[model samples]
Target: MSTVKIEKGQAFWLADPQEHDFPAAYDYLELLFVPEECKAFVDKLRGATTIKKKSKDILRASALPLLPDTNCHVKENLRKIKKKEKLSPILLVRANGKLIIADGYHRLCASYYFTEDLDVPCRLV
Candidate 1:
Protein backbone atom coordinates (compact mmCIF):
# COMPACT_ATOMS: atom_id res chain seq x y z
CA MET A 1 0.00 0.00 0.00
CA SER A 2 1.11 3.59 -0.61
CA THR A 3 1.14 6.49 1.87
CA VAL A 4 -0.61 9.21 -0.05
CA LYS A 5 -3.61 8.63 -2.29
CA ILE A 6 -2.56 11.16 -4.91
CA GLU A 7 0.35 13.07 -6.42
CA LYS A 8 -0.84 16.62 -5.70
CA GLY A 9 -1.09 16.56 -1.87
CA GLN A 10 0.57 15.26 1.32
CA ALA A 11 0.41 15.19 5.17
CA PHE A 12 2.80 16.52 7.78
CA TRP A 13 3.43 17.78 11.35
CA LEU A 14 4.97 21.10 12.37
CA ALA A 15 6.65 22.73 15.38
CA ASP A 16 9.80 24.33 16.68
CA PRO A 17 13.09 22.52 16.26
CA GLN A 18 14.10 19.78 18.60
CA GLU A 19 17.49 18.20 18.59
CA HIS A 20 17.90 14.61 17.53
CA ASP A 21 20.63 12.51 15.96
CA PHE A 22 20.66 14.96 13.05
CA PRO A 23 24.21 16.06 12.40
CA ALA A 24 25.25 19.53 13.49
CA ALA A 25 26.70 20.34 10.09
CA TYR A 26 23.15 20.11 8.78
CA ASP A 27 22.33 23.38 10.52
CA TYR A 28 24.01 25.37 7.80
CA LEU A 29 22.29 23.56 4.96
CA GLU A 30 18.99 23.23 6.80
CA LEU A 31 17.75 26.19 4.78
CA LEU A 32 17.59 23.87 1.78
CA PHE A 33 15.94 20.42 1.81
CA VAL A 34 16.95 19.09 5.22
CA PRO A 35 14.83 20.10 8.21
CA GLU A 36 14.37 23.85 8.22
CA GLU A 37 12.92 23.90 4.75
CA CYS A 38 10.28 21.33 5.63
CA LYS A 39 9.10 23.38 8.55
CA ALA A 40 9.04 26.57 6.53
CA PHE A 41 7.21 24.97 3.66
CA VAL A 42 4.64 23.27 5.86
CA ASP A 43 3.86 26.40 7.79
CA LYS A 44 3.10 27.99 4.46
CA LEU A 45 0.90 25.01 3.58
CA ARG A 46 -1.07 25.45 6.78
CA GLY A 47 -4.86 25.67 6.38
CA ALA A 48 -4.51 25.04 2.67
CA THR A 49 -5.09 21.32 3.12
CA THR A 50 -5.71 18.73 5.77
CA ILE A 51 -4.49 15.30 4.76
CA LYS A 52 -3.66 12.02 6.43
CA LYS A 53 -1.89 9.11 4.80
CA LYS A 54 -0.19 5.85 5.56
CA SER A 55 3.58 5.56 5.80
CA LYS A 56 4.00 3.83 2.49
CA ASP A 57 1.85 6.33 0.66
CA ILE A 58 3.88 9.24 1.98
CA LEU A 59 7.04 7.55 0.75
CA ARG A 60 5.56 7.33 -2.69
CA ALA A 61 4.98 11.08 -2.65
CA SER A 62 8.63 11.63 -1.90
CA ALA A 63 9.97 9.56 -4.78
CA LEU A 64 13.10 9.28 -2.69
CA PRO A 65 15.95 7.14 -3.87
CA LEU A 66 16.63 3.78 -2.28
CA LEU A 67 19.33 3.68 0.37
CA PRO A 68 21.41 1.44 -1.91
CA ASP A 69 22.86 -0.21 1.18
CA THR A 70 21.75 -0.37 4.79
CA ASN A 71 24.00 1.31 7.28
CA CYS A 72 24.42 0.18 10.89
CA HIS A 73 22.19 3.09 11.91
CA VAL A 74 19.41 2.18 9.52
CA LYS A 75 19.61 -1.48 10.49
CA GLU A 76 19.40 -0.53 14.14
CA ASN A 77 16.41 1.77 13.56
CA LEU A 78 14.66 -1.00 11.65
CA ARG A 79 15.16 -3.42 14.50
CA LYS A 80 13.93 -0.93 17.04
CA ILE A 81 10.84 0.07 15.07
CA LYS A 82 9.97 -3.59 14.41
CA LYS A 83 10.18 -4.16 18.13
CA LYS A 84 7.64 -1.34 18.69
CA GLU A 85 10.00 1.31 19.90
CA LYS A 86 8.19 4.41 18.77
CA LEU A 87 10.27 6.64 16.59
CA SER A 88 9.91 10.38 16.36
CA PRO A 89 7.62 11.61 13.58
CA ILE A 90 9.28 12.19 10.24
CA LEU A 91 9.87 15.70 8.92
CA LEU A 92 8.82 16.66 5.40
CA VAL A 93 8.61 19.67 3.11
CA ARG A 94 6.69 20.33 -0.10
CA ALA A 95 8.46 21.57 -3.17
CA ASN A 96 6.98 21.70 -6.66
CA GLY A 97 4.09 19.58 -5.33
CA LYS A 98 6.40 16.85 -4.11
CA LEU A 99 7.02 15.78 -0.53
CA ILE A 100 10.67 15.90 0.40
CA ILE A 101 11.93 13.95 3.36
CA ALA A 102 13.85 16.29 5.61
CA ASP A 103 14.27 13.69 8.29
CA GLY A 104 13.43 10.09 9.26
CA TYR A 105 14.28 8.60 5.87
CA HIS A 106 15.79 5.54 7.45
CA ARG A 107 12.80 4.99 9.67
CA LEU A 108 10.48 5.42 6.73
CA CYS A 109 12.41 2.91 4.67
CA ALA A 110 12.36 0.43 7.52
CA SER A 111 8.63 0.75 8.06
CA TYR A 112 7.89 0.42 4.35
CA TYR A 113 10.07 -2.65 4.07
CA PHE A 114 8.05 -4.40 6.76
CA THR A 115 4.58 -2.98 6.14
CA GLU A 116 3.11 -0.25 3.99
CA ASP A 117 0.16 0.24 6.34
CA LEU A 118 2.26 1.68 9.12
CA ASP A 119 0.92 5.05 10.28
CA VAL A 120 3.84 7.42 9.93
CA PRO A 121 3.54 10.52 12.02
CA CYS A 122 5.10 13.57 10.38
CA ARG A 123 5.49 17.30 10.86
CA LEU A 124 5.31 19.36 7.67
CA VAL A 125 6.71 22.83 7.44
Candidate 2:
Protein backbone atom coordinates (compact mmCIF):
# COMPACT_ATOMS: atom_id res chain seq x y z
CA MET A 1 0.00 0.00 0.00
CA SER A 2 1.10 3.54 -0.54
CA THR A 3 2.43 5.57 2.38
CA VAL A 4 -0.66 7.76 2.32
CA LYS A 5 -2.92 4.73 2.51
CA ILE A 6 -1.01 3.34 5.46
CA GLU A 7 -1.13 6.70 7.17
CA LYS A 8 -4.86 6.81 6.72
CA GLY A 9 -5.13 3.33 8.19
CA GLN A 10 -3.01 4.36 11.18
CA ALA A 11 -5.03 7.48 11.63
CA PHE A 12 -8.18 5.41 11.72
CA TRP A 13 -6.85 3.55 14.73
CA LEU A 14 -5.46 6.65 16.40
CA ALA A 15 -8.80 8.38 16.14
CA ASP A 16 -10.30 6.05 18.75
CA PRO A 17 -13.35 5.11 16.74
CA GLN A 18 -15.37 4.53 19.89
CA GLU A 19 -15.71 8.30 20.18
CA HIS A 20 -17.65 8.19 16.87
CA ASP A 21 -16.11 11.12 15.03
CA PHE A 22 -14.55 9.42 12.02
CA PRO A 23 -17.15 8.82 9.36
CA ALA A 24 -14.52 7.56 6.96
CA ALA A 25 -13.82 4.64 9.24
CA TYR A 26 -17.42 4.13 10.25
CA ASP A 27 -18.67 4.15 6.65
CA TYR A 28 -17.87 0.51 5.88
CA LEU A 29 -16.74 -0.79 9.26
CA GLU A 30 -19.64 -3.19 9.56
CA LEU A 31 -19.07 -4.49 6.05
CA LEU A 32 -15.43 -5.20 6.80
CA PHE A 33 -16.33 -7.32 9.80
CA VAL A 34 -19.05 -8.43 12.15
CA PRO A 35 -18.56 -9.35 15.81
CA GLU A 36 -19.75 -12.91 15.36
CA GLU A 37 -17.57 -13.40 12.32
CA CYS A 38 -14.54 -11.94 14.04
CA LYS A 39 -15.23 -14.10 17.07
CA ALA A 40 -15.50 -17.15 14.83
CA PHE A 41 -12.24 -16.27 13.18
CA VAL A 42 -10.52 -16.12 16.56
CA ASP A 43 -12.22 -19.30 17.66
CA LYS A 44 -10.87 -21.10 14.62
CA LEU A 45 -7.39 -20.47 15.94
CA ARG A 46 -7.92 -22.73 18.91
CA GLY A 47 -4.54 -24.34 18.47
CA ALA A 48 -2.87 -20.97 18.16
CA THR A 49 0.18 -20.39 20.27
CA THR A 50 1.06 -17.14 22.02
CA ILE A 51 4.75 -16.46 22.08
CA LYS A 52 7.27 -13.84 23.03
CA LYS A 53 9.81 -12.94 20.41
CA LYS A 54 12.19 -10.14 19.61
CA SER A 55 10.50 -6.92 18.55
CA LYS A 56 12.51 -6.90 15.35
CA ASP A 57 11.30 -10.41 14.64
CA ILE A 58 7.69 -9.27 14.34
CA LEU A 59 8.67 -6.30 12.18
CA ARG A 60 10.38 -8.68 9.77
CA ALA A 61 7.53 -11.13 9.88
CA SER A 62 4.95 -8.45 9.24
CA ALA A 63 6.17 -8.10 5.64
CA LEU A 64 4.43 -4.74 5.76
CA PRO A 65 6.23 -1.63 4.72
CA LEU A 66 7.39 0.61 7.56
CA LEU A 67 4.51 2.73 8.76
CA PRO A 68 4.59 6.51 8.46
CA ASP A 69 5.45 8.51 11.57
CA THR A 70 2.21 10.30 12.22
CA ASN A 71 1.98 12.01 15.62
CA CYS A 72 4.60 11.59 18.35
CA HIS A 73 3.00 8.31 19.17
CA VAL A 74 6.18 6.30 19.09
CA LYS A 75 7.96 8.71 21.34
CA GLU A 76 5.07 8.68 23.76
CA ASN A 77 5.18 4.93 23.87
CA LEU A 78 8.90 5.04 24.45
CA ARG A 79 8.33 7.40 27.33
CA LYS A 80 5.91 4.93 28.84
CA ILE A 81 8.50 2.24 28.48
CA LYS A 82 11.02 4.45 30.18
CA LYS A 83 8.58 4.93 33.03
CA LYS A 84 8.43 1.13 33.31
CA GLU A 85 4.72 0.91 32.85
CA LYS A 86 3.38 -2.38 31.62
CA LEU A 87 2.35 -2.35 28.00
CA SER A 88 -0.39 -4.50 26.57
CA PRO A 89 0.56 -7.20 24.15
CA ILE A 90 0.37 -6.40 20.48
CA LEU A 91 -2.24 -8.15 18.36
CA LEU A 92 -1.50 -9.54 14.92
CA VAL A 93 -3.75 -10.93 12.26
CA ARG A 94 -2.43 -13.21 9.57
CA ALA A 95 -4.01 -12.39 6.23
CA ASN A 96 -2.89 -13.65 2.85
CA GLY A 97 0.37 -14.88 4.40
CA LYS A 98 1.26 -11.49 5.80
CA LEU A 99 1.18 -10.50 9.45
CA ILE A 100 -0.76 -7.30 9.95
CA ILE A 101 -0.27 -5.49 13.23
CA ALA A 102 -3.92 -5.16 14.18
CA ASP A 103 -2.85 -2.90 17.03
CA GLY A 104 0.14 -1.48 18.96
CA TYR A 105 2.57 -0.53 16.24
CA HIS A 106 4.02 2.36 18.23
CA ARG A 107 4.58 0.20 21.27
CA LEU A 108 6.36 -2.35 19.13
CA CYS A 109 8.65 0.24 17.61
CA ALA A 110 9.42 1.70 21.02
CA SER A 111 10.16 -1.73 22.47
CA TYR A 112 12.39 -2.51 19.52
CA TYR A 113 14.28 0.73 19.89
CA PHE A 114 14.81 0.19 23.62
CA THR A 115 16.25 -3.19 22.82
CA GLU A 116 16.04 -5.03 19.53
CA ASP A 117 15.84 -8.23 21.53
CA LEU A 118 12.97 -7.02 23.69
CA ASP A 119 10.53 -9.82 24.11
CA VAL A 120 7.13 -8.85 22.76
CA PRO A 121 4.13 -10.98 23.58
CA CYS A 122 1.95 -11.61 20.55
CA ARG A 123 -0.82 -13.83 19.31
CA LEU A 124 -2.24 -14.46 15.85
CA VAL A 125 -5.87 -14.02 14.87
Candidate 3:
Protein backbone atom coordinates (compact mmCIF):
# COMPACT_ATOMS: atom_id res chain seq x y z
CA MET A 1 0.00 0.00 0.00
CA SER A 2 1.09 3.57 -0.54
CA THR A 3 2.95 4.84 2.48
CA VAL A 4 0.78 6.93 4.79
CA LYS A 5 1.69 9.53 7.35
CA ILE A 6 -0.85 11.19 9.60
CA GLU A 7 -0.37 14.74 10.73
CA LYS A 8 -2.09 16.83 13.39
CA GLY A 9 -5.24 18.81 12.64
CA GLN A 10 -5.73 17.72 9.02
CA ALA A 11 -9.00 16.06 8.14
CA PHE A 12 -8.88 15.43 4.40
CA TRP A 13 -9.79 12.65 2.01
CA LEU A 14 -7.03 12.21 -0.49
CA ALA A 15 -8.63 10.62 -3.54
CA ASP A 16 -8.03 9.49 -7.10
CA PRO A 17 -9.30 12.64 -8.77
CA GLN A 18 -9.54 10.37 -11.81
CA GLU A 19 -12.65 8.95 -10.14
CA HIS A 20 -14.39 12.06 -11.40
CA ASP A 21 -14.50 10.29 -14.78
CA PHE A 22 -16.39 7.35 -13.28
CA PRO A 23 -14.16 4.83 -14.99
CA ALA A 24 -15.65 1.52 -16.09
CA ALA A 25 -12.70 -0.23 -14.51
CA TYR A 26 -13.83 1.16 -11.17
CA ASP A 27 -17.44 0.00 -11.68
CA TYR A 28 -17.26 -3.73 -12.47
CA LEU A 29 -16.33 -4.87 -9.01
CA GLU A 30 -18.95 -2.72 -7.29
CA LEU A 31 -21.82 -3.38 -9.72
CA LEU A 32 -24.99 -4.75 -8.11
CA PHE A 33 -25.20 -7.44 -10.80
CA VAL A 34 -21.92 -9.07 -9.93
CA PRO A 35 -21.59 -12.78 -8.98
CA GLU A 36 -23.50 -14.33 -6.10
CA GLU A 37 -20.49 -14.46 -3.82
CA CYS A 38 -19.79 -10.85 -4.48
CA LYS A 39 -23.40 -9.84 -3.89
CA ALA A 40 -23.36 -11.70 -0.58
CA PHE A 41 -20.24 -9.86 0.38
CA VAL A 42 -21.74 -6.52 -0.46
CA ASP A 43 -24.75 -7.39 1.64
CA LYS A 44 -22.49 -7.71 4.66
CA LEU A 45 -21.31 -4.13 4.39
CA ARG A 46 -22.34 -1.72 7.15
CA GLY A 47 -24.60 1.28 6.52
CA ALA A 48 -25.24 0.63 2.84
CA THR A 49 -27.24 3.48 1.39
CA THR A 50 -28.29 5.12 -1.86
CA ILE A 51 -28.00 8.61 -0.45
CA LYS A 52 -25.11 10.60 -1.86
CA LYS A 53 -22.74 11.49 0.92
CA LYS A 54 -21.65 15.12 0.87
CA SER A 55 -18.43 15.31 -1.10
CA LYS A 56 -17.59 18.75 0.19
CA ASP A 57 -17.73 17.40 3.71
CA ILE A 58 -15.29 14.70 2.78
CA LEU A 59 -11.51 15.16 2.52
CA ARG A 60 -9.93 15.83 -0.87
CA ALA A 61 -6.86 14.60 -2.71
CA SER A 62 -3.45 16.02 -1.61
CA ALA A 63 -2.87 15.38 2.06
CA LEU A 64 -0.34 12.55 2.10
CA PRO A 65 3.19 13.28 1.02
CA LEU A 66 5.93 11.00 -0.34
CA LEU A 67 7.64 8.52 1.94
CA PRO A 68 10.67 9.75 3.77
CA ASP A 69 14.17 8.27 3.39
CA THR A 70 13.64 4.62 2.36
CA ASN A 71 12.67 3.68 -1.21
CA CYS A 72 11.18 0.28 -0.71
CA HIS A 73 9.10 -1.12 -3.62
CA VAL A 74 5.70 -2.17 -2.32
CA LYS A 75 3.81 -1.76 -5.58
CA GLU A 76 2.44 -5.32 -5.76
CA ASN A 77 0.79 -5.07 -2.36
CA LEU A 78 -0.54 -1.66 -3.24
CA ARG A 79 -2.13 -3.07 -6.42
CA LYS A 80 -3.89 -5.69 -4.33
CA ILE A 81 -5.15 -2.97 -2.02
CA LYS A 82 -6.56 -1.08 -5.01
CA LYS A 83 -8.38 -4.17 -6.29
CA LYS A 84 -10.18 -4.62 -2.97
CA GLU A 85 -11.10 -0.94 -2.81
CA LYS A 86 -14.56 -0.55 -1.30
CA LEU A 87 -17.55 1.27 -2.79
CA SER A 88 -19.79 1.08 0.25
CA PRO A 89 -17.91 4.11 1.48
CA ILE A 90 -16.15 3.39 4.73
CA LEU A 91 -17.55 5.05 7.78
CA LEU A 92 -15.56 6.66 10.55
CA VAL A 93 -17.70 5.93 13.53
CA ARG A 94 -17.68 7.45 16.95
CA ALA A 95 -18.80 5.72 20.12
CA ASN A 96 -18.20 8.68 22.37
CA GLY A 97 -16.74 11.15 19.88
CA LYS A 98 -13.46 9.64 18.76
CA LEU A 99 -12.64 9.29 15.02
CA ILE A 100 -11.71 5.89 13.72
CA ILE A 101 -10.90 4.19 10.41
CA ALA A 102 -13.88 1.90 10.23
CA ASP A 103 -12.90 0.82 6.72
CA GLY A 104 -11.30 1.92 3.40
CA TYR A 105 -7.63 1.66 4.27
CA HIS A 106 -6.86 0.51 0.73
CA ARG A 107 -8.82 3.34 -0.77
CA LEU A 108 -6.80 5.61 1.47
CA CYS A 109 -3.60 4.20 0.03
CA ALA A 110 -4.89 4.24 -3.53
CA SER A 111 -5.71 7.89 -3.05
CA TYR A 112 -2.09 8.45 -2.23
CA TYR A 113 -0.98 6.74 -5.45
CA PHE A 114 -3.32 8.82 -7.59
CA THR A 115 -2.38 11.95 -5.73
CA GLU A 116 0.65 12.31 -3.52
CA ASP A 117 -1.86 13.02 -0.76
CA LEU A 118 -2.83 10.61 2.02
CA ASP A 119 -6.16 12.06 3.01
CA VAL A 120 -9.36 10.09 2.24
CA PRO A 121 -13.14 10.29 2.15
CA CYS A 122 -14.77 9.69 5.50
CA ARG A 123 -18.22 9.79 7.05
CA LEU A 124 -18.72 10.57 10.70
CA VAL A 125 -21.33 8.43 12.40
Candidate 4:
Protein backbone atom coordinates (compact mmCIF):
# COMPACT_ATOMS: atom_id res chain seq x y z
CA MET A 1 0.00 0.00 0.00
CA SER A 2 1.14 3.55 -0.78
CA THR A 3 1.11 6.32 1.80
CA VAL A 4 0.93 10.05 1.14
CA LYS A 5 3.20 11.74 3.61
CA ILE A 6 1.83 15.19 4.27
CA GLU A 7 3.79 17.81 6.18
CA LYS A 8 2.37 16.72 9.52
CA GLY A 9 3.21 13.04 9.03
CA GLN A 10 2.26 10.01 7.00
CA ALA A 11 -1.37 10.00 5.94
CA PHE A 12 -1.69 6.32 5.29
CA TRP A 13 -4.37 4.39 3.41
CA LEU A 14 -5.35 0.81 4.08
CA ALA A 15 -4.30 -1.77 1.52
CA ASP A 16 -7.90 -2.98 1.34
CA PRO A 17 -11.20 -1.25 1.82
CA GLN A 18 -12.55 -1.30 5.35
CA GLU A 19 -15.31 -3.82 6.09
CA HIS A 20 -17.83 -1.14 6.90
CA ASP A 21 -17.06 0.76 3.74
CA PHE A 22 -18.70 -1.90 1.57
CA PRO A 23 -22.04 -1.47 3.26
CA ALA A 24 -21.66 2.29 3.10
CA ALA A 25 -20.99 2.03 -0.60
CA TYR A 26 -23.94 -0.27 -1.05
CA ASP A 27 -26.19 2.11 0.81
CA TYR A 28 -25.08 5.11 -1.21
CA LEU A 29 -25.27 3.15 -4.44
CA GLU A 30 -28.85 2.18 -3.61
CA LEU A 31 -29.74 5.83 -4.03
CA LEU A 32 -28.63 5.60 -7.63
CA PHE A 33 -29.26 1.97 -8.49
CA VAL A 34 -31.67 -0.78 -7.66
CA PRO A 35 -30.82 -2.86 -4.62
CA GLU A 36 -29.71 -5.82 -6.72
CA GLU A 37 -27.50 -3.64 -8.91
CA CYS A 38 -26.09 -1.91 -5.88
CA LYS A 39 -25.05 -5.25 -4.47
CA ALA A 40 -23.38 -6.17 -7.73
CA PHE A 41 -21.48 -2.92 -7.82
CA VAL A 42 -20.34 -3.37 -4.27
CA ASP A 43 -19.16 -6.86 -5.08
CA LYS A 44 -17.12 -5.53 -7.97
CA LEU A 45 -15.67 -2.82 -5.78
CA ARG A 46 -14.65 -5.45 -3.27
CA GLY A 47 -12.77 -7.40 -5.91
CA ALA A 48 -11.19 -4.38 -7.56
CA THR A 49 -7.52 -3.71 -7.12
CA THR A 50 -6.39 -0.55 -5.39
CA ILE A 51 -5.19 2.22 -7.68
CA LYS A 52 -3.85 5.73 -7.13
CA LYS A 53 -5.56 8.67 -8.75
CA LYS A 54 -5.32 12.41 -8.34
CA SER A 55 -7.86 13.86 -5.93
CA LYS A 56 -8.73 16.73 -8.25
CA ASP A 57 -9.29 14.42 -11.16
CA ILE A 58 -11.70 12.31 -9.15
CA LEU A 59 -13.76 15.35 -8.13
CA ARG A 60 -13.84 16.48 -11.71
CA ALA A 61 -14.77 13.08 -13.04
CA SER A 62 -17.51 12.64 -10.47
CA ALA A 63 -18.81 16.17 -11.02
CA LEU A 64 -19.36 16.42 -7.26
CA PRO A 65 -19.08 19.69 -5.43
CA LEU A 66 -16.39 19.62 -2.83
CA LEU A 67 -17.80 19.64 0.64
CA PRO A 68 -16.60 22.67 2.56
CA ASP A 69 -14.51 22.51 5.73
CA THR A 70 -17.62 23.02 7.82
CA ASN A 71 -19.20 19.82 6.59
CA CYS A 72 -19.24 17.48 9.58
CA HIS A 73 -17.94 14.50 7.65
CA VAL A 74 -15.27 16.54 5.94
CA LYS A 75 -14.21 17.99 9.26
CA GLU A 76 -13.92 14.55 10.79
CA ASN A 77 -11.88 13.31 7.86
CA LEU A 78 -9.66 16.36 8.13
CA ARG A 79 -9.09 15.60 11.77
CA LYS A 80 -8.14 12.04 10.89
CA ILE A 81 -5.76 13.28 8.22
CA LYS A 82 -4.11 15.73 10.60
CA LYS A 83 -3.73 13.02 13.19
CA LYS A 84 -2.11 10.74 10.63
CA GLU A 85 -4.72 8.03 10.86
CA LYS A 86 -5.10 5.30 8.30
CA LEU A 87 -7.92 6.08 5.91
CA SER A 88 -9.97 3.64 3.90
CA PRO A 89 -9.47 3.72 0.16
CA ILE A 90 -12.40 5.16 -1.74
CA LEU A 91 -14.77 3.03 -3.81
CA LEU A 92 -15.72 4.13 -7.33
CA VAL A 93 -17.98 2.97 -10.11
CA ARG A 94 -18.03 3.93 -13.78
CA ALA A 95 -21.45 4.28 -15.32
CA ASN A 96 -23.23 6.36 -17.94
CA GLY A 97 -19.84 7.70 -18.98
CA LYS A 98 -19.49 9.34 -15.60
CA LEU A 99 -17.77 8.45 -12.37
CA ILE A 100 -19.72 7.70 -9.24
CA ILE A 101 -18.08 8.04 -5.84
CA ALA A 102 -19.57 4.99 -4.20
CA ASP A 103 -17.90 5.96 -0.92
CA GLY A 104 -15.25 8.23 0.67
CA TYR A 105 -16.43 11.56 -0.67
CA HIS A 106 -15.40 13.24 2.55
CA ARG A 107 -11.96 11.75 2.56
CA LEU A 108 -11.39 12.89 -1.01
CA CYS A 109 -12.50 16.40 -0.18
CA ALA A 110 -10.36 16.45 2.96
CA SER A 111 -7.32 15.24 1.06
CA TYR A 112 -7.96 17.90 -1.57
CA TYR A 113 -7.68 20.54 1.13
CA PHE A 114 -4.08 19.46 1.48
CA THR A 115 -3.33 19.26 -2.27
CA GLU A 116 -5.42 18.68 -5.37
CA ASP A 117 -2.55 16.65 -6.75
CA LEU A 118 -2.57 14.25 -3.85
CA ASP A 119 -2.74 10.67 -5.06
CA VAL A 120 -5.68 9.09 -3.30
CA PRO A 121 -6.05 5.36 -3.12
CA CYS A 122 -9.24 4.02 -4.65
CA ARG A 123 -10.87 0.76 -5.62
CA LEU A 124 -12.29 1.61 -9.02
CA VAL A 125 -14.60 -0.73 -10.91
Candidates in order, TM-scores: namely 0.59, 0.60, 0.31, 0.91
Per-residue CA lDDT of model 3 for 1-125, tens digit only, reads 33434344444433322233222222332443345633343333333332223332233322223332233333442444445433333443333343333344344444455444333444444
Descending-lDDT candidate ranking? 4, 1, 2, 3
lDDT of each: 0.55, 0.53, 0.36, 0.87
Of 2 and 4, the candidate ahead on lDDT is 4
Regions more than 4 Å wrong, model 3: 1-45, 48-77, 80-88, 116-123
Error of 2 at 86 (Å): 0.8
Model 1 quality (TM-score): 0.59
How should the candidates be ordered by TM-score, best one leading?
Answer: 4, 2, 1, 3
Error of model 4, residue 117, in angstroms = 0.2
Task: Score candidate 4 by TM-score against the native.
Answer: 0.91
Which candidate do you rate higher for TM-score, 1 or 3? Answer: 1
Better of 1 and 4 by TM-score: 4
lDDT of 3 at 83: 55
Model 2 lDDT tens row, 18-51:
2222222223223456756545544433334656
Candidate 4 per-residue lDDT over residues 1-125, each given as its tens digit:
12434775465677888999999999999999899999899989988889999999999999999888788898887778778787899999998798999999999988888888888999998
Candidate with best TM-score: 4
Off by over 4 Å in 1: 1-18, 21-52
Estimate the overall C-alpha local distance difference test score of candidate 2.
0.53
